[model samples]
Target: MSAVLQLLVLVVLAPYLVGLMRQVRALMEGRAGAGIGQPWRDLRKLFRKEPISPDGSSWVFVAAPAVLAATTLVIAAVAPFAATVSPLDGVADLFAVVALLLLGTVALALAGLDTGTAFGGMGASREITVAALAEPTILLAGFALSARVGSTNLAAIVERGNHSPGDLLSPATLLAAVALAVVVIAEAGRLPVDNPSTHLELTMIHEAMVLEYSGRDLALVEFASALRLTVLLGLWVNLFVPWGIATSEAPLALLGGAAVFVVKVAVVGAVLAAGEVFMAKLRLFRVPELLAGSFLFGVLAVSSSFFLA
Candidate 1:
């Protein structure tokens, strides 16, 4: 029951989260911008249209969106979103979750190349480059956080955290939080790494790769992209701040937990929106440097745990 609720929230609320971010950005910039329902409308419009594939594109192009969205849904289910325990915890480990996300990334990258367009190839190259740099930071950062509970399984980490929340304020925790925050920006294709609203092929990382997709395919891809951001942010929040998460499967606790989870994610959404307002997108060549700095933070986080904690 908790698993079902978790999955539903991830799927149904993911687009709304994206819309909220846009609205937040819009208000910060002093423009009304698109309303909070814009993403939902966009998805509905895309699904109602016809899907077209690029010439010579293989089945991978057609299948990448499903794979991406499915993997994201899987991650959300396995993680303890609104509950301290997960219905799918048996298959959910920190390492396994990260690997599943990487699988989706690889599939999309291959699909980008399969399109045989220069923009597709360019996007794939840039996305893969960032993925390679970001992957290490993810592993190291997760390790830093997991080290406190002495486990790499996310459920275990969250469960242990319920018993012991003191470590969340330690130097190691702060370092890991900073590292993961940087990763979230890069992984989710946010500003300073990549812009979701941009059409400039030369500067686009994620949008460029999916430029050839249309209709349902594009809807799935865009929905998956939004889901990706939502899941990653939720996971980070649950990891760093496990407050209000129900440790039981009781109905009331689930309700309370769900409400708290939404509030927490909304707060995070606003912070991310405000953050992008202050920073401009970095040059493509300088992206690696930003990722490298994140890697350093992750390493320091791990080392601090060993030496200081």
Candidate 2:
């Protein structure tokens, strides 16, 4: 029941979160911006249009959006967003969650290559490159966090954090948080990594891959992208700031947890958006260096957990 509520909240609130981030960026830039409802309106418009496929595309192209969306939904359902005692808690292993995320990324990369367009191929190459660098940092950070608890289960990590607040301030935890923050930015294709708003062929990483998608396919892709961001941010919050999460199964506790979850995620998203306003995307060749630095932090985190124990 808690898992279902988390999934519903993610599906319904993800778009508005995107809109909120965009609005924050706009406001920072002194623009009035479109209202927060704009993303929902854009999604509705996209769903009403007829989907079109590229002439040479195969089943991979037709299935990538659904595959991507399905993987994200799975993560949202099993992850400890609102409550620590979810029905699917047994399956919420950190490695499994990371693998599911990579599966969606690989599916979309394959779809990009399947399109046979030069831009698609280029984007696929870049996306895979970024994923290769970003995903490992996520694993290392998760392992660092899980080391103290002796279990890779995400619920165990969060529940432990809730019960032991001092762990959140440890050297290992702080280092892992910094590493994962960079991973989230890279994985979500945000600025200083890949500009989500860019359309230029030379600069596009994620956008180039989906250039051929239209109508319902486009809507699914966009929504999945938004949900992925929300899931990543939510996971980060629950892992590092598990104070407000419900540890029990009571209805009131679950409701309060859900409300707190939204507020935390929104605050992080707004901060990220505001930060991006003052930053510029890194040169393509330099992105690997940034990710490599994050990976180093993950390594340091692991070392800190062992030595500082």
For lDDT, the strongest prediction is 2
Error of 1 at 59 (Å): 0.7
Give the range where candidate 1 is weakest over 10 consecutive residues by summed lDDT.
Answer: 84-93
Model 1 C-alpha lDDT per residue in residues 1-309, reported as the tens digit of each score: 888888888888889999999999999999988988899999999999999998999999999999999999889887888886766886778888889889999989999999999999999999999999998999999899878778888878777766778888889888999998999889999999999988996799999899999999999999999999989899889888888988889999988888898899989988998888998999999999999999999999999988997
Q: Residue 244 error for model 1, in Å? A: 0.7
Best-performing candidate as measured by TM-score: 2
Q: Candidate 1: misplaced stretches above 4 Å?
A: none
Model 1: which residue pairs collide? Answer: none
Give the Å shift of residue 153 in candidate 2.
0.1
Question: What lDDT, from 0 to 1, does candidate 1 have?
Answer: 0.90
| Worst-scoring 10-residue span by lDDT in model 2 | 195-204
Model 1 CA lDDT for position 88: 81
